[model samples]
Target chain A: MKGLAELGEFGLIDHIRARFPQPVAPELGIGDDAALLSPSAGRQVVVSTDLLAEGVHFDPGFGPARLLGRKSLAVNLSDLASMGAIPRWFFLSLAIPAGFSLETIEGFLDGLAEQAAEHNCILAGGDTCGSKGGLTISVTIMGEQRPELILKRSGAQPGDDVWVSGSLGDSALGLKLLMEGVRLGGAHDPLLLRQLDPTPRCELGLKLAEAGLVNAMIDISDGLLADLGHICEQSVCGAEILLGQLPLSPALYTCSSKQPVFPWPLVISGGEDYELCFTAPRCNREAIQKISKTAGIPLTVVGKVTNSRQVQAILPDGTNFQPSASGYTHF
Target chain B: MKGLAELGEFGLIDHIRARFPQPVAPELGIGDDAALLSPSAGRQVVVSTDLLAEGVHFDPGFGPARLLGRKSLAVNLSDLASMGAIPRWFFLSLAIPAGFSLETIEGFLDGLAEQAAEHNCILAGGDTCGSKGGLTISVTIMGEQRPELILKRSGAQPGDDVWVSGSLGDSALGLKLLMEGVRLGGAHDPLLLRQLDPTPRCELGLKLAEAGLVNAMIDISDGLLADLGHICEQSVCGAEILLGQLPLSPALYTCSSKQPVFPWPLVISGGEDYELCFTAPRCNREAIQKISKTAGIPLTVVGKVTNSRQVQAILPDGTNFQPSASGYTHF
Candidate 1:
């Protein structure tokens, strides 16, 4: 945030780049007049963008540039994954506070470099400006998916199996603990870790796309119920989920300390998980299992698609429950 | 600035988009799941980004978002023009102030859409966030060029004819007058307008690029002297410029109150002209004229490349003119 003159622009870039290894892509990653990328053949590129503001997105003390860079890219990557696409390139534009230092700027860039490399994405271009305000990170991601194999929110249909990948609620809990002043290395350490470094199911997404096992897809970034409702809305259909069948995690269960917990909020309202939530036709069940085995990740079936335009949940006692709210509202 | 909640997220987008028609390129502009664009052929994309902070880049009241959008894209497009590239897509990340209304956002978007549509470029994707402090904008532009024809800042040589398109200092003058409350009409009006919407010389840029008329190129967003210093540093050479050769408009002359006045500040230290300043072989004078005629833009010879790495200026009276320290300083 200090005037760019204080740190010198070139030096600032080098500092930010120190935290990240060169991306896995064959060409350049950070420093360049331009970036070179190899796109998959016969694929329509999928592009998405998201911006994170200082106060609205994270606590400045806890959400360092490293995490911010990762989360920024992670959220966009999740969007591409929802379409069953392979991420390739990214553009980052950041605004730092006037009092910010070169070292802090570097931290942010380092974070971006690290996460971009992890996903095999090239950091092609970006801009720097001295803002009179808080820190903001804007990321645009490019992904490519085979023309016909791409998944859409509206592809869900009656009898399609609704499945989710990986653990959830940990991020939400982590955020909660942070908000509640819970110390690290406490009983909820794992949950805290999940919140800090939430991984996206990019590999699973690509596999599901390649094997044609997904009908409708979305990322569990906005929580289960909210994200699930997106597919329902787009497909103009209802859904039925058995509460007991929900993929509740161990940390979530342990948070209750042996007491039976409703877990509705954890599974339904916990967001920022970056996991994949998708629906597949019955014919692709074996393919889904094969992916689960090959990727060494569990693919849990949570429910099924329906013909009606309502979302109904059956509790452990066999009583139907409806979502209290759909998803997070940024505004 | 008004709180973001006054307009809501979707309402903000609509307000911004209301100013113009959809962006020129199809597939993506605004209001969609994602923006889409096609990259130009055979070229590794040339991309660059710059972040503008409220207090650093502009005062909110002095420049509108439309101008900001144009300036943001123009700056990146300026980078692409420097590389002899044609821009195609852009991604914008904006952090709106907590006290702003959706109408304020629309003012910015209106400018962005107008400029983008004029250039046949599309708003591929970007992020919008609520800031705790002031406004910030980060723009990333993507462009394409033939692999072999791309120009660089380091290609200037002795004996090259230094050239620039359009008159310099108009935009800067417009800014000064507007900020200082000095006003004029006719050609002067355009000069002030130029400050808010300086043309990027993109068409001339493409022509000069394809015709190979220039050795090196850069856009005059930063003052001519400062920007010229960059080319000199990169190319490891010097330059000799003649003040009389500078293209100053009639309005600039009238600024001295109907008397002949040396407006070198407008010519040399002035920035945001968005014109192409380049070096070409002296032998290409005819080609330059041909391009000038074809592109319907003036291409004038202003000076020559020099042997040493110092920038020397010859004033109208044959006196040496040293450049002042003031120019566009981002930090």
Candidate 2:
């Protein structure tokens, strides 16, 4: 395959346009100056944008280009999922270095296409250009949901039960292993996959939103405590978390038993989990439990909202728990 | 002022969110995982995304940070203008290098706010992160328009008169002077300002769309001939332009007389002019002229659409004209 420079910008655009055909009717997709979409009647639009730089977000040599592509879209989809919106379309802008092979670009797009297809999202419009440095990918995803059903971080009230979907800390631990150059062999290694290709809990979020069970919701991208602090700050409340109730995956436990060092703090402060964390009134606990069973995702009660206006964690032995680092800092 | 590293990502975000306050209702602005917007009744949505890398798009040392900020949003707004949509909201994702001063970022945002305020567009949501290399800014702009009022490049027909708004070639000429190390005095130099801060033709586009006077419309970001070729290709037609009809700015002529280097080819092949080019039926020429007079812009007929599928130019001497270069190539 020819390199990106050899393919030229127009050829690369044509290749991408061919991969994602335009949708029929009311919306005009790619190949135009801009995309035209008819917003669904009675629904509000949800939008989010994210940037993933080469060295800052991911190391190209550490993971497959396909996984990077999946992760790029997955991260933005998680934002929409957190808002309980149904993914519909996305715009991708990429800055590719001169040295990038066309195969690498294809692999990345293939992975992105697979994820978009899973969510029935369409490629609307985008821009591509040469980069003097490493590859930079920026994505803007759009979704739609009923206005009244929209959940916001400011909706949490004191005395509400705090809950989390799925396990935590696996992705942070996976990143640690990868940074230390520990390859667990197969591509399907559970821990490595958790870091490389985290799933957006769209189904669970939709189910919870439709059931009207959650008062407030957020995706756990910046670890548990930091993100919970965001909710507490906005809702003008506090929370008390039981450290023992934090869900740790079997893969994390197995790795910890084999290694001398245990990554305990990662459960609360590590990032890139992409799981849903929400609060609900205790009266709706049974309904949430039924939703968890139907959605096939584990729902764990980790804490309760409080009036103290501070986020504090309690250890299993009844001592105050503190982490060395709060979460990932961009700067 | 301190560098970006000293401000930290969250502090920078807070700084930005403070500048652009959220709208009163019907739309949720920044400080959230995703932004929620209610689309206007009976209006379709329009979207466009663009990326600008530091080295590829601009040289920071040669221009003011405020102009770069203005240009960043201006280019995306031009896309919405080309589609005849009313600008509403935009998402910005920036990758800022560690050494960038806080003043530079604030300057850029100030210029962006100026342009956004002029168009009545709001900053909905965005992501800011650290960059290993130079600054990379990506923007996704959204707008709304009635389905029937939207303009596209695929609507031109044979016998249509091709028209362009405002003058051309001045920006390209100005860029040539700057590249040659010719700083033409103050910040208000007309040529330099034309190149550094081009305006989007939103008013003219809206008037044409509202009057239903144009068969096709496109923004001249990729030069006159190349962008005209886009309309021809999509509309399945050809164009024959008259060289004498090309509108050259007085600044270009003055610079040419002083430099003794005539850049005539730039009139048809240069990029980044951000002017509107369209085609209308011969019968509606009077109406278009009336629109031009009412909108306070110069609308000139530069060519005519043909049944054949080739874009050709005729010199004033009644001979065929061929440009030295077609247009700007991204890669």
lDDT digits (tens) for residues B1-331 of candidate 2: 7777777888888888888757668678887789999879999999999999988888786577898889999999999889899999998899988777889999899988889888898999899998898899999999999999999999999999999989998888778777877664754278777788889998888888999888999999888989999999999999999978888887777767776645667778888889999999999999999999999989999989999999998988888888877887666
Which stretches of model 2 miss by more than 4 angstroms? A258-261, B184-188, B258-261
TM-scores of the models, in the given order?
A: 0.87, 0.98
In model 1 chain B, the worst 10-residue window by lDDT is B25-34
Which pairs of residues collide in model 2?
Answer: none
lDDT of 1 by residue, A84-180 (tens): 7888787777776656766666666666667787888766656555556677777778877766777777789899999988877788888888888
> Candidate 1 at residue A160, lDDT?
93
Best by TM-score: 2
Best by DockQ: 2
* Count of backbone clashes, every candidate in sequence: 20, 0
CA lDDT of A63 in candidate 1?
51
iRMSD of all candidate structures = 3.1, 0.9
Score residue B87 of candidate 1 by CA lDDT: 82
